[model samples]
Target chain A: MRTILSVLLGVIAVTTAPPALAALNVFACEPEWGALVTELGGDKVSVYVATTGRQDPHQIQARPSLIAQARKADLTVCTGAELEIGWMPMVERSAANARIQPGAPGAFEAASHVRLLEIPARLDRAEGDIHASGNPHIQTDPRNILTVAKPLSDKLAELDPANAAYYDNRHADFVHRWTQALQRWQAEAAPLKGVPVAVQHKSWVYFFDWTGLREIVALEPKPGIPPSSGYLAQVLEQVRREPVKMVIRAAYEDPRPSEFLSEQAKIPAVELPFTVGGTDGAGDLFSLYDDTLHRLLEALGHDSSKP
Target chain B: MNTTRFVIAACAAIGALSCPGTGFAASDQELKEIQQQIQALKSEYEEKIKSLEARLEAAEQAARAAEAKAAAAQTGVAAATPPPAPPPPAQPVAPAAAGAFNPAISAVLLGTFGQFSRNPDKARIPGFELGPDAGAGERGFSLNESEVDLAANIDQALYGSLVIALQPDNTVNVEEGYLQTTSLPWGFTVKAGRFFSGIGYLNEQHIHAWDFVDAPLPYRALLNTQYGDDGGQVRWLAPTDWFLEFGGEAFRGDAFPAANGPGHGKGAGSLFVHSGGDIGESSSWLAGLSYLQTRAGDRVTGADVFSGRDHIGIASLVYKWAPQGNPTQRNLILTGEFFHGLEEGTFDGNRFDQWRDGWYLQGVYQFMPRWRIGFRHDELDSDRLAGVFAGGTLDNLGHVPRRNTALLEFDTSEFARFRLQYTRDDADLTTDDEVLLTYNVTYGPHGAHRF
Candidate 1:
């Protein structure tokens, strides 16, 4: 009996070697945030991504499965610049989890930390369609990702205090690689030197600034307006006259206008990854830059190494 | 290859123009640079058109254009459906996922079951429900679903779902039809193909989309025979969250139960107005009124006797509130509506009064996270006229039918439901006792967000 008890005790100690730690259940509304969580948490947290990166976050339908994911999540992070206003309210209700209620610590609206652009002169629900507060595409700006990293690491620590230092160290390592990559991107974009571009929608502002590309014209006469034939013709006329290098847009935007212009005028259209994993070729965060910058350079025919 | 030839010609021209002092090494680099630029341009076109084109509607158009350059690029859908249904057994989706494009399409498809019988009153199939359960039903599946739902994001801003039902016969049916959109500027949206009208909350929703699995009887009466409007609609939301919608649709081309006209007259148009957004922390409401008119195009209604069309108006008040903090998570809904329809417009010159009124008070209480119980009381004051077969007067067979129902539902999940209902039907046409027991289940992927 003594021999058996001692052996069992040894096995129990071995199994219980790791300190009892509360499991982290995190919900990321978009795939980019999910990737970030994966990079930072490693094995310390469990993550659920509400929408795939390929999907436009603004137009998600509140499906029951998504709500279920929300229900079980301990922390819910959304790219909330009112980007998900159409469906997030419904997703939140469907999840039936009261812990991650908006304005609650368990819920993080990532856009809150970043500076917003295109602030409407007058804000009202009556103004057709409007983002009541901010534009939520901050993930495209890697700097914002770095800025939010501190908070994410801190939140993870609060949830699992035992691994606080480990989370901090990971954030530091991410900063190093992320900065290095950004420097290279900035240098490569130099030839893009104030090259004029036309954007189909307002999604590419941060990316345009980061790359030093100037947006000479926008297709939409008004925000969110579906391009009319007249508008397409007008844009073609403008491009034929101006010094525009390429027409840019996010993935999932309508391609009809781009094609019409590309055919009518010879300006090539460039579709960039709006979020990480927006394309299979652009899998993770770092590689996403490689894909985007490469596409831009290729559109301008600036990649001198290719044969 | 043509571009390659152009590059070679340009290189030769450059060599002839260059000064003898310029080195061959510099000229060689320039030629190589031109070649590289051409290749880069080619790659950019290829990547945008083939790989990421599916992401943008415009990119898709460009991709289709690019596809023409390659004989193998048959269609814009890609050379091969990139994400093939991952080898069946390990696939996450049901093999027979009804409709491929939209959950709304499948919602109508899976929820509907119909029959053509010599006797219009009774059903040839014993297993399915035909009439009086959902409203004006005649020997067909109610297609009115009470369910659990799931949906996954397809591309940015677009979602897909499947609805599963719970009820007698334990059948499944589609509740939503075709495309649905919530992202639009200036608070506007568009829906195309077969989908429920946005006249009232109940009419726009599936039984599974409701807090109570069974819809109130009046909603059924008003929307009977016309749950889904097959054309398209445009909705505009005002700054005050007030919504104005103008919609028109063609009727289902069902062979039997034909329309009142000869050539495809079965189409409808509607005008709706309402406001959205929460009223406060504890309550929210959607108040609206709508008018719907349908011309009997599908029917070959007896020409001289019943050749005309129909019109209906719905005024609804939907109030939602919670005694606790969460309104939808736990709440009470009080809804009331009055509907009126006119028939025999083409057959008879005279216009008679055809009015039906329905009202309900319902409440849902969540006892736990995944489980909840809902109860409702509904009564409809109906005046449905059944004309004489041979020939009839305005006074013949016109009776006021009053029905009251008590329904109990258990929500297994917000998107899935199991319901049991008993109704007491008293009508001028019948004096007999009527008792009914009904069960229904429904669900959609992320079905919680349709409202």
Candidate 2:
């Protein structure tokens, strides 16, 4: 009888304890932002990522879990150049969290910090799912990540002022490490300058600008349209004349188009980790860039171990 | 000798004084000409400086006017077109400030060519009466109903969505129009307006998203195609690891099954609970239970009126499997729902109680990225009433109804689909076979459907 009473008292103590309030809840729309939030917030925040590495960020199905997470978030981060236009608005409306509403201090967008590429000179639906704001795949280049980190950390501090010092220190440390990594990458990737390549989509324009890899042609007929047989033939003809070394594609994209081009043009198809967790080695922001360079260098028949 | 020397000195002194006076006159004239040239150069430079200052002032005024015009144009664009919020610190496209009210508009066109083994005039259930608009379309080349949808955020705390369906006979129906609260506290949302009831799984989905060309036998018999009425609803989502939801609705109950009366007060109400979660890396499942109850005052079916209480209960389960978490390439879905209803009422001056039940099971498999095949089976059972009822059609009372359907569909793109379906319906003594080929296309911005 005494033991039973003791067990009952123990259960009451466990159930009545208050939940940890020090941890801020964060909702990230993609895996890259999720990794960034974790890197900065550490144990001071709990994060929920809405999409996996394999899923396309352009469209997502409406789920109750997403709404539930959004409702509880203190800060919501996303690549907001219309990348999530298909469902983000609806999710925001459903979650009804005033803190994470547009224009709120808790709402952060990474694309706003970086200089967006591929701004269409004209707007037309015939362009095939073109974003009016610009290209939203900004996480491919590490330089853009460094640019976004400063503002995102400030946003976190604004939302949770108690953790301002923590965010500031972490952001400063990240910037320092990131600058050194950028220098190392530039030195190692000197050989890739002026190397002509073909891409499956326009997602790699920023990455190309960083590495000095020349994009000779694209496999996609338009922005999002798959190439027709006639279009593929034209690309093949262009590739034969220009003689590109490799065909590049994101790991999430279908490999069939790249493979078809590779077979016809007799070039290698190299799949790059477009964001964090895109490949096995790309577990964080640092490894994401490391793996991307390693694959690109390996495709060029150069030893990545030396770099 | 002294007198001659003095005369020579005086002549030499006069010659020296006259020569000095002539040189001074020549130097004074040259100095006056040089002073005139210097005055002309100073006046020219002063005139140039005055004109340059006027040009500079004009250019500055023009620049200020241009800036103001650009600001007005920015506001005009914001008011005219509902632009999405601009990213921070970028002045390229000024994000709509507070008044961005652009609503998403979409339209869906559904067309079908159906071939029936027999005349559609004989398509009737034994002991059931069809509604006014329940008949299938005319034999060949008939236009099906098309839908136009408009949705927008009403304000910071509310959202509005409307769908209007255009019928083949040049009539328009407001299928659904509702305003729902978005930012309710404690995971609660309230919706007010006309909407489909939160009944079984497939009831809330539009026909364009249906697996088959038409609703199953159970849905048609129990809910008259789909149960929608002017109503108010409240839904709550649980804060849990898995997906859990509870909802309740109060409707006017003016549509079929319920009598047309003053649609105020608690005419009809329903309660439902649903839960779903992933089973493993590649599989997921959802299950739900719902209950609805209403009082029918002078409800007319065929010729008789049912005045009493009606209750319905539904249970549904769905399981989906996709290999390696990629549903685009291949997936399989198995879903089923069972409905049971009880009606106690006075039929043609005679008191009668009846019980009815129906169920359907369907499975769809996508063999490839863009191709899929599906099969569905429906079965229904009803309790036969004894004694003759006045002004009613109850000829074959004890027959069980069933149907079998098979479909093959191809999705050309995300916005276009083509399907061919064959159904063997055995609702009457004489079975009917229907073969329908359908094409569905969507235009504009369409939101992603619920999973």
Candidate 3:
């Protein structure tokens, strides 16, 4: 009887201990994405962003330590649409965790949920190197986050089923609060709508779509071509003709071209948080919109809140 | 007191009856006296301390009771309103990767395009021979290479790949078809069917994965096969961070078109040993030794077929220096390799020299994250150059002189590459200019080739 009693005590001691808290491992390829995940996940997830807002996510090296982290990750996510054509292959190989491989249960490609932009008319290898599925940087729009939130909530629930209800509640609360926030920002930005803006790259299509901002000029002669002296002169003429207010740039891209154009045009050079965590206020998944909207609102010379 | 001392001393004397230094018997009377004395002392100390402690506890309880009564009386007056306490701050969540697809199937589309141009001074190359100097124009995109790789994971442990790519010669071909071993025993993996061989570091990496647009000359000069062979390779790794790989391939001779002719291999095989690790905080390297042997039908010698054997060995060292907050804004990498090969051929005709040897060294510097430039120099020599290079009739020929080359290149991404290289042909053959630009793409799923 005593032996049995001792065995039961041993079992009870082993079974009843609280599980040790594991640091949440979060990986964001772009700063905007990182900022958004950070805001939504808050202190619950540990973030390891691959690219700063200042660096291009398209050309990140496949560092060994990054691979080791991805191998053990409870979840692995990336920007799809061939944005990571050079880097993703290495990540898939080195991230040996079965769950994070292409079809693994914990693996995800984030671009699948949102409405893609900049689809190529001729989608062949011979046409020139282009993303076939669509342009991958779709996070510039607040509405895109609305579509991603459902999947984000589902993923968080799947990863931590123990906290499913908590995540679901947080996601619901975030959606409601974000909807309200967007409305206010939209009202403030209403006058800024149809505002003529000059840009270096075609990265602001989503933002332009949402805000109805007019692209008055591009510094580049063609899309993706860095502006030449002649092209810049032409853009200056175009901007002067259209009377632009601001010249915009994606956070990760070089600001030199737009800055030059802004200097010539005598307008403020506005840097937008194209990816999550690209801006100071970019914190959560919903904050992708927050950073972009706040920056645009500020660029348009408006008070941000509670006026 | 003196009489009492005398009595005590007398008792002591009686107790001394139990003598020392001897195994004396125990006296119950003596034991009883000692036990009684001990009990008296214990009782005395215990009673004193116990009384003192009891008094202290009584005083403490009285004070505590008074303090509690006062506090309770105050609380009862305003129990409905609780004092404000600061709320705990929310903790920060850690950053992590994005998205998930169930283990059954996940798909991603990959594509690439590039332009090719050659120096005008170089002789006109056939549209097919030159990388960029195709039949038509300079720096054109019609021949841009693209591919889509569809990948699927089965049973959560086996990964399968299917690839379709626009070949450099302007045709789509099956670039990859193989299964990668994922969940293996102690890092032991077996790859069957067609896959790239782990012959060299650059051999396994895709064209898109290269730091430069065009491949280094050593790969073409040393290893006969262009990319890899369709073979089965089994790799084993030890806990000590060392790896051993062995593979044999049975491929059609036509699969690998050799420069000598549509030959050099009917079947091929290779074996390699690789071990690499970090030397210090930020320094790491891969040290490896490998060998490859192949058999192909030779048609260049005409009626008499020639068979050849290539023995290759290499040792390379690369160092990377990246300092924080650099004014240059560059991740400067200096890498070089020394490769040697001795290839001997056997033919039915009176062949003079069947042995060939060569080596190369190269350096690459990444000026920016996606933009890099590199340079390489190589020399190839053979003791016996009977008929191949010196334009000899059937048997007699001059010594196969060394062919030396200097090349420079630049790269953007895997799928898109741009290069400007000059190969110096110092052999008896024509010293022609050879420049090339190649582009790569993957379709279906963006998975890597076999390592």
lDDT of 1 by residue, A4-90 (tens): 869855754564343335378788988778878777887777887776654556545554345545655678877787787668867
DockQ of each: 0.04, 0.26, 0.04
Instruction: Give native contacts recovered, as a fraction, per prediction.
Output: 0.07, 0.22, 0.04
What lDDT is obtained when candidate 2 is compared to the true structure?
Answer: 0.78
Better candidate by DockQ, 2 or 3: 2
Write one digit per residue (lDDT tens) for candidate 1, span B287-375: 67787666554233223333345566777776655532233224555666666555444335444444445566665555533345555
Which candidate, 1 or 3, would have the higher lDDT against the true structure?
1
For residues A59-156, what per-residue lDDT tens digits would candidate 3 score against the true structure?
45554445545544556667676777656656555454455566666665667776676778875544334576677776666666666666776886
* Residue range B389-422, candidate 2, lDDT tens digits: 4324543356888989999998766677899989
Most accurate candidate by DockQ: 2
- Tens-digit lDDT track for model 3 on B208-289? 6555444444554445324464657776543221222233333333333222323432565667765454334344455566
On TM-score, the stronger of 2 and 3 is 2
Model 2 residue A306 CA deviation (Å) reads 5.4
Q: What is the C-alpha lDDT of each candidate?
A: 0.57, 0.78, 0.55
Candidate that beats the other on TM-score, 1 or 3, i.e. the better one? 3
